[model samples]
Target chain A: MVVSVAHLGPPGTYAEAAALAYVNWLNQRGQQGLLCPCPSIAQTLRAAAQGQADVAVVPVENSVEGSVTTTLDTLWQLDKLQIQQAHVLPISHALLSRAETLEEIKTVYSHPQALAQCQGWLERFLPSVQLVPMNATTEALKYLGEDKTAAAIASSRAAQLYHLPILVCPINDYPDNYTRFWVLSLQPSGGGSHTSLAFSVPANVPGALVKPLEVFASRGINLSRIESRPTKRSLGDYLFFTDLEADAREASVQSALKELTAYTETLKIFGSYSIVSIGKL
Target chain B: MVVSVAHLGPPGTYAEAAALAYVNWLNQRGQQGLLCPCPSIAQTLRAAAQGQADVAVVPVENSVEGSVTTTLDTLWQLDKLQIQQAHVLPISHALLSRAETLEEIKTVYSHPQALAQCQGWLERFLPSVQLVPMNATTEALKYLGEDKTAAAIASSRAAQLYHLPILVCPINDYPDNYTRFWVLSLQPSGGGSHTSLAFSVPANVPGALVKPLEVFASRGINLSRIESRPTKRSLGDYLFFTDLEADAREASVQSALKELTAYTETLKIFGSYSIVSIGKL
Candidate 1:
């Protein structure tokens, strides 16, 4: 059986690399999978939701940059899609272009994150060049082949694949850049050993968040991470997303979940997933 | 007293608007203040740090978008500056250009947040147009005036200020979009009614964050907001920035701060500020 994976693409992106890594793990277990690239993270999730792909692997967090809000917001909007597994990838960006000199480059295109990561370098070297945003990092490389004056900030793999000159290597401000990606599927796998979930506290309650969080703390369940998004209804109201070390189906976690509802206005389990730590490439 | 306000600028951006609003408030209090337009938020903060400006007013959060991460990161890095006041301003983005129609807008320029907020509209109408990132939303207006085919997503004020045609009146996806800004000063204001601060919990301590949060909960102090940034020293380690309803000068809040240190490895008080709520314009 083939397990088709979807990710934001044109192939040499970090998202595509993550999908490949997940496919590689599946192959070790005697399963075969191929990647299907989509134009955006929204489209990548849609491919899985629409049954065009078995799962979609998309970056949800960056160590230096914090949460990938697009992926998080998309997952929150499409409530049914569940995280089947999570993966960590070390990231390094390269400046790719066909120009013989930096002076010849008039425009640089990349994902906003990439541009932000290398902003200092751009300011110092090409202060006047235009920085354009593309849907994805590797997708930005497409513009490089068409215009000699256009450059892209993407993975080293993109430079190799696209046959573009490596204008600069390791363009990111931080050498410790790493991103976490989640394998999302339409149907719950119901097997992984960890859980991802989101909840919103009762607005205006003094200890609204603390009560729901206590449910996990009392049970000795440690939380891996927590993120908050404004509720948009008012200034202080928010929706909290968290990842816990315990699975939703576990007896202890199950009881914690039951008590959690008393403090939270909304609770959603994005489902269980084992963490695959492939540290650095 | 001469109040110098620092903000990101080329004149027509929201940050400039924030600085102007702050200056206006100071004027109402029978004081004169001048706006100091900097090239970037980092520079704006630097202007205050070096005493070139009396204070810096920068966006901290948006209603639709979560955090203004650049401002957050800059605040974390420059630990000396303290929040003197907080202000909320309703946001509305407009498409500015010399182009007669959307079809003629071959390139769209904006601050990344503006572009993201208008992503749906851009995708629906000008799917194939190039998106360029500028340092500020107002900074993008510079490109619009120079290139007739270039369009910018900025405040309606930019249209009048730059004499550019308004291609679209309200380009943002959400009409209720608003941004929260903080006035930063070198020393504590001592007058504001509330406080903003950041702390890092010791790694590997189970419920480390819970213990510190409980201090506020036990004191009945309401937290207005909380944001976490990866500590970068290790995995799952994060520095949490939080805004609470009590000031450091208050006896209850002072004791809570003392109790917080027991559960945290590093703590920094970003100082007290009063809340200023200015609803949609």
Candidate 2:
């Protein structure tokens, strides 16, 4: 089967790198595929849900940045799309510049996420420099080619794509910066045994969270994540997003989900997909 | 006693709004005052630890977004700074423009966080327009004065500061959008009766999380937030950031912290402060 992957932005984003990695993985296994790029996570999920793409790859969380709200919110909102597999990509930032020397660099450019990730490094290395922020790291790279004094904090791959030289590599404050991405698709393939769901509990109820969680604990289903986002309609009301080891189709998981619905004001099963192993970089 | 409050930007940002709310609260109670505006969360905490600020206000989590990793990481890294009090400030976004009509809006500008928060509203309201992302919403508002077709997504206060007219108000997708901010001080006087800490567990150990969490459960300490950020050193290693009731000086909490240290690879207390009321706008 051909799998079409969707990612954020044009061609040189970290999302694109992840999508390419997934494509290469499929190709190495002798699987045929097409990787379709989308401008945003929402568009990518929409494409996958509408069968325009068989599977979509989007960033769900960042090790140094916590959860990507857009991805999580989209997963909660999109009823047809389900997470099939997850991948964690190690991220090493690079300072790219069109100019050859540090003396010539004046303005530094990058996506805010990239800029924030390398905050300490930038303060230490380029304290007096003018930091110019942009929409995407690729855009910064693109603009660097036009403005000689400008540098960009982007993936090393982005530097190469824009024909810019890396002034410094591994520029992030934390050496272990990584981004977690998830594969979303319409089909619930039970072969990949993982599921994600979103739900809300009644406000002011004591042990409201514990009761739903106990359902998973009793069933021996390992919960990978449990996060709460404010429901945004009232004070103290929260929507909980959770990841579990068993697929929603499994008897135990289904029973747990059913029991959870009784305790929760609202429950949504996002998707169930077999876990995908991240092959070597 | 004097309190030092820290926020995100120079003078304008949501963090500033929340900090001001905190300051107003202190003023109403006739407390001594100091406001420290740090460029980032790390700087804010550093100022607190270094005794530059009596207390600092930093964004920890948001209703739409889950957690701010910078705040979480700074808490993890800093040995002295602690969370004294937590407050939730309601966020209302506005579309500020120099031009009067939607037809004149050729570009929209905002901070990445603000832009992401208003994504659904922007897609629905201005689908055909170009998005001109900026470093801060205040910067966007500043630029709007120079460009006729540009509108900025920022707070009403920003519009007032920049002397721009509000074309639209409360444009966020979530009507109940709020941001959770923690006040950090070197000495724990104003924070009253709560403590926050960061802890890490051994890699590849199943149920390693349950033990420390059980301390809270067993003691009925009431956990407010629990977040996992990858260690980045190892593939599966993670650091958990949690907030619980009771000050560090409290017998039960101190005992739990002592018990928790034996069970985890690392345990650090961020701060203890009095809990603040979740403000209504």
Candidate 3:
């Protein structure tokens, strides 16, 4: 089967890295055809909605940065695309430059999130230089290749692809920086190891979260992640995106979902698929 | 009293805007003095520890985006600067331009967070334009002044200061977009109306969070916010930062803290201060 993958940039981005990893995983299993790259998460989901792509991959959360709200907001808007799978990729940043020395670098460039993640390191090491920002770290790398006095904070893979030398390695403030990505698709697959879904409940209801959680607890199912996003439509309303460590077919899992639908204002099971490791990508 | 402000820029940034707002608030209260504008949160805390400033203001969380991890991480490290006060500022973004029309705008610039916050609007309005990321929204305005085809996503204040016309007003995706700021001080003030603190519990320990939460619940004190950050030193250890409605001096609040400390392995009161409204600024 063919799949369309949507990431953050043209190429050589962490999102692209994650998407490629998924592509390689599918290819190895002899089950892939096309992987289309999109510029933003909204565009990715739009492509899936229009049937231009079968599936899209987007970053959901970063260990150091918490959550990617763009993806969350887009997911909230799109009703067709369901979260089918997930993968966590370790992120290591590097300061890349065309010039040889820090003295030659007058300006540094990177995505704002990348810059923020490395804020402490940049201040301590490169205090006098000006920081220039770009939409994606890959674009920063591109600018670095063209400008002699500018450096870019990007992944090691980007530096290699762009032929920029690494001025500083692992520039992120946290050593264990990781990004969690979700795979979205229109068709729901069965016989998967787990399922991911997003739902919402009435706000300010003291025990609202507990009742849905009890469904899993009663059946002895494990929950991988649970996050809340404000609906923006109202002050108190919240949409909860959750991941469970079991397929929908499981008796307890089905029972939990059946009970959850009655209580929650809205519940949607995005999709079910096998979980894959980064190394497997 | 002198204050230290930690912001996200070298000189001109939206962080600077927020910092200036805090400085103006203090100055208006007849406490006019120099405010040390540090480039990073860590530096701000370091300044506080070194007794360079009496208080520091840092952005803790944003409504549309969620928590600012750097501020949270730096707070976890310093153990000196405590939350003295909290304020929520409404964020209104403007598209600052040196050129008049969208056709002349070759590149759009802003902080990565600002860009992400306006991703929906940007994608729909400017699909083909290049997005230049900068350290702060203010710096993006600087770029716009220099580049004829560039427009910057910045606050209305920046546009007014730079004499750049606003192409689009309130371009952010959400109307309720606001940022939560914390005024941290070296010493706790006796007349505070609210309290903020940080603590941690072992991961996967069932009801570990609930036990500490019960302390405040039993006292009928409302929690304003609760966020989790991974403790870098340990794999599963998480540091939880919480804000409560009542001041630490309150009898019930004090009793709750005493009870909480007993159940918690690590608990620290960060600060006690009155809540400030956005209108007050």
What is the C-alpha lDDT profile of model 2 across A178-252, one tens digit per residue?
Answer: 787887778765445668888887643335566677788777887776666656565445687877777687898
Model 3 over residues B10-77: C-alpha lDDT tens digits?
A: 45455666667777887888776455667566677677666777766778777777777778877777
Off by over 4 Å in 1: A97-109, A119-134, A139-151, A279-281, B98-107, B123-132, B142-150, B279-281
TM-score of predicted chain A against the true chain A, for each candidate: 0.92, 0.90, 0.90
DockQ of each: 0.49, 0.36, 0.29
Candidate 2 ranges beyond 4 A from true positions: A1-3, A28-31, A202-206, A212-221, A245-265, A270-281, B1-4, B29-34, B189-193, B245-255, B278-281
TM-score of each: 0.92, 0.89, 0.86
Q: How accurate is candidate 1 locally (lDDT)?
A: 0.84
Cα-based lDDT at residue B10, candidate 2: 58
Ranking by DockQ: 1, 2, 3
Evaluate fnat for each of the predicted models and list the values in order: 0.39, 0.25, 0.12
iRMS per model, in Å, is 1.9, 3.3, 3.8
Instruction: Please give the distance, in angstroms, between residue B180's alpha carbon in candidate 2 and its true position after superposition.
Output: 2.6
Better of 2 and 3 by DockQ: 2
Q: Return the top candidate by DockQ.
A: 1
